[model samples]
Target chain A: MGRKLLLEHINVPGINTLEVYRKTGGYRAVEKAIKTMSTDEVVEEVKKSGLRGRGGAGFPTGMKWSFLAKPEGVARYLVCNADESEPGTFKDRYLMTNIPHALIEGMIVSSYALGANTSYIYVRGEMMPQIRILEKAIAEAKAAGFLGKNILGSGYDLELYVQPGGGAYICGEETALLESLEGKRGNPRIKPPFPAIAGLYGCPTVVNNVESIAAVVPIINDGGEEYAKIGIGRSTGTKLISASGNINKPGVYEIELGVSVEDFIYSEEYCGGIANGKRLKAVVAGGSSVPILPANLILNLVNGDKRLMSYESLSEGGFTTGTMLGSGGFVVLDEDQCIVRNTWNFSRFYHHESCGQCSPCREGTGWMEKVLHRLENGHGKMSDMDLLVDVSKKIEGNTICPLGDAAAWPVASAIRHFRDEFEWHVRNPTLAVKENFGLAHYADPLPELVS
Target chain B: MLKVEETQSVEFSTELVNKFAEIVSRYPEGKEKSALLPILHEVQAVNGWLSSVAMDKVAAYLNIAPIEVYEVASFYSMYFLRPQGKFVLEVCRTGPCCLVGAEKIIDYIGEKLGVKEGEVTADGLFSYRGVECLAACGFAPVLQIGPEYTFYENLTTNSVDQLISDLKDKASKS
Candidate 1:
């Protein structure tokens, strides 16, 4: 069994209640941090633990905390990004639904660490159930004296509120979330003034992912060094992978960071392999935004090293033969699935979700979607593939936020890794719409490495 | 924009007004504009959708301009600007769900309801549309109904039929 820090007691009945969660050692971090350690000490402990943001970017958590600008008499805020809208990514929703108090406890400890008296968890509006759950849990915690003025007799004042997003995926971005929290349209802000420097009502703020904040409880419980000792290299501690799409066990699994891709898929511990005895065709290791990898490339690196689930290991070859461990939304495609259809599906999602703050992302995503739609519907020309590549390149980095790059990567990567299937569509036209090209060479074994 | 065709005015109930007041209290004093989204949700939940009058009243309640509310209400996929069926079936249509048959489920719902996507039924009881990921891909081919956003997952055509009938039964009882 792997070490389950955040979800150790997830399956216990009544775990969502404060009483059962308390029995399972919840809120111990709040007591320890508020009553014993100073704010800087809590931050230092997280820094030593080497925790990275689990919300796709993989940026170091402690470093993000340190970036908060603290001017005297200026209030600091910590906002939890609970907007888990990326397709194939559902870990935050699962964690929030099953273990609501875990997040509340982390909020208390993290708010103390940042010396902020106010915090909010910006959840997506579609998760009305989860927002209600967190609200109930927060009220229970407040009644227990875990929140509000002078918590646990420690003279630390904190108020945590659950903010609902208006169903915009762009709000998952830190600045866009802050904008939404301020009752504005979800538009990405230009950087030189990142959210850490000035955010939410123009205060010095720190926006952390829900998982990153929840991981703080365990880090503060056992010392940071003990927490850091679990996983390999910089990818310390366990990560929750939301396995979906053609997998037998399509659910959230927390694994120690170094598990190999093959074992994670085939082993009964994780995904339990592709569903219904089907052969794996391809995998999107991260969420939809990351590059999709062919079966051979996903199973083994270009150098023939077995790919592991750690941030460094999964991204070893850097886009050519490797993909990100983004948000840990591991989606698997069986041989029966069509890459062209899936690509078109993802393009449509991006096009619909483009916030339209930047012209390139707004226009480019629509163009890609239309072109891919035609390609899938048997109306594409041979030059359509290159046109897609060209348009995607134009949108890659020309926007106010990474949503542009996100809109670009899947289209580019699909063409890079699966051009032949696209060409087959252009040539076969009507036949392509009637049937898929099937697995083709995607599942073939990688050529042996020459010494 | 506000559907000018539907010019029906709405009056906020005292209880809902109090609820709006509570939502506004969650933000800092000068930042009552922050209460806009939550207030709009509450308004939409009470009435089936936001009319020009309802949004104007929400703006007055929050002391912000009606355009502010209009821009936000329009920007979000939620917050129906026009009236909808009492039960809106939002099925997931993103990549992962499609991999596991979301599209087929959407088509089945449309066929069974005798209404296309975004169109209300003749009885005005149900409307269905393909929404983006609901963050429940593991339980792919999922659909949810609004007002509470209750989820129904791992759907087949039979499950969808059962759900529509159950919802019809529910509406009849209510």
Candidate 2:
């Protein structure tokens, strides 16, 4: 059903190779933009397309591009953030591994628009296989004249390299990524001189997420207005939702924006409902960093309006009642899952990845993890619930990078929505260790568990 | 306990040297320090782990201080501070994976290997550790063996034993 834009030819045979990709209208976007469109035209087209950044922030892409400082005799850069380390988000890995050329093609067009002669795709180091896949595709593109000097004889030149991050999720933050790109510790830099003004080696830079960059090909092919018309309102173009956890079909699905949340989870064409006929309890609509919503809030607004999967709709009530479409990492949880245990697990992840840069983030994340660990293991106090919220609130918006807030949102929201479940853990410590708190009020009119 | 002092001159093969040169060239002139991450990858691939010698050699090659190489290498989780076994089983233990029995998967690897997590077997054939999300949660209970870059998905306790045996077989052959 829905119109597929980014992943139209995803399953085509040999699409991974440059030859097959080129046959299926792969590099045409490059040719059209380079030979026909001016650099300003390309930038203006993206602005008109209403394309927002897919890297979780949802900032306008064209505005981010236009911010690049074009200082005289200075170089600018386009670094693709391929560090797909956000838990439950594998779309970037899926894209780069299966259809590498689309990213390569998009990189060429985007590099031209930013007037950057060199670009780097900073992929997480764990995806070594993906790095190899991209390296092969880049070499293939270079030999075909899509890369290197005077590409397609349009007088624009670009060189793209696939750099590996040494396994730190903080590096996914653009400034931290640039620091790691320069072979330093992955501590994030402060603002004012945003990456657009002073980045990598003190040169102006534009670091876009992998999907954001790859989506450029489709926008150029369809024209800005045409591309903008596909998705509902400001959530223009298609988005790759990587669905996992308690879903019958857990994989990446490229859905046109504005698909209803209920349809995406219940329809056979998408997630095909919860696995094993289990009742849905909670779902992290975005990645692990975003707030987790119980089934009631995820499916409907407070005013009983049916919720759709768009930037505006998902975040309707802000952090209190709604969550983000962050990174499109749709993780679903069924009735049998324990919110306390799950929150504890994510708290530990944030603690492990704190980067030790800021006092609040470095200290607060660790304290949250330790306290949550106590609560999950049945040693929690009734006061520990409030302590968790207090610690989470302190870390949010206090660090140089969003990782601190990313750590805080899940814990804070879980306690906000599921205070009863957390309270039960403290009350029934022995039973909590032996069994999960179960669905409770997570799913309204809860269906009986199948098994 | 972690090795840092060098004992001998560290050298790269001609092919590796050429690859390093190509990587360095990607950065601007005098910005060769940016090649530190990839060069460390190359060194680890060649020498098994980054000994003080290899790191100092990377530092000398980049014209940066050796401390620059050490601090950067230690901050990242991928670089082995010690020489791990031939097969490093990095199990994804984040929320999604844990929801699908990742805790049991990791526990099984540790029990079967007869070593604690992060400790190599005496034979140096395998090492196991619980790592954070590898972003492949759709196939939950996943593990990656590096620097071979192979992923084992949907793992059970029995499959883990079979995996360890298969890796042992391959390790003996190579």
Please list the C-alpha lDDT of all candidates, in the order they appear. Answer: 0.92, 0.90
How does residue A22 of candidate 2 score in lDDT?
88
RMSD of 1: 1.7
DockQ of 1: 0.90
**Candidate 1 CAPRI assessment class:** high
True contacts kept of each: 0.88, 0.84
TM-score of chain B of 2: 0.93
Clashing pairs in 2: none
Q: Which residue pairs in candidate 1 have backbone atoms (N, alpha carbon, C) closer than 3 angstroms, thus clashing?
A: none
Q: Write the per-residue lDDT of candidate 2 for residues B1-174, one digit (tens) a residue.
A: 223345756689999999999999989998898999998988888776788888888888899899999999999999986778778899999999988899998888888888999888888788889999999999888999887568889899988889888887887888
Q: Which ten residues in a row have the lowest lDDT in candidate 1 chain A?
A: A442-451
Residue range A264-348, candidate 2, lDDT tens digits: 9999989999999899999998899999999988998777788899999999989878999999999999998999999999999
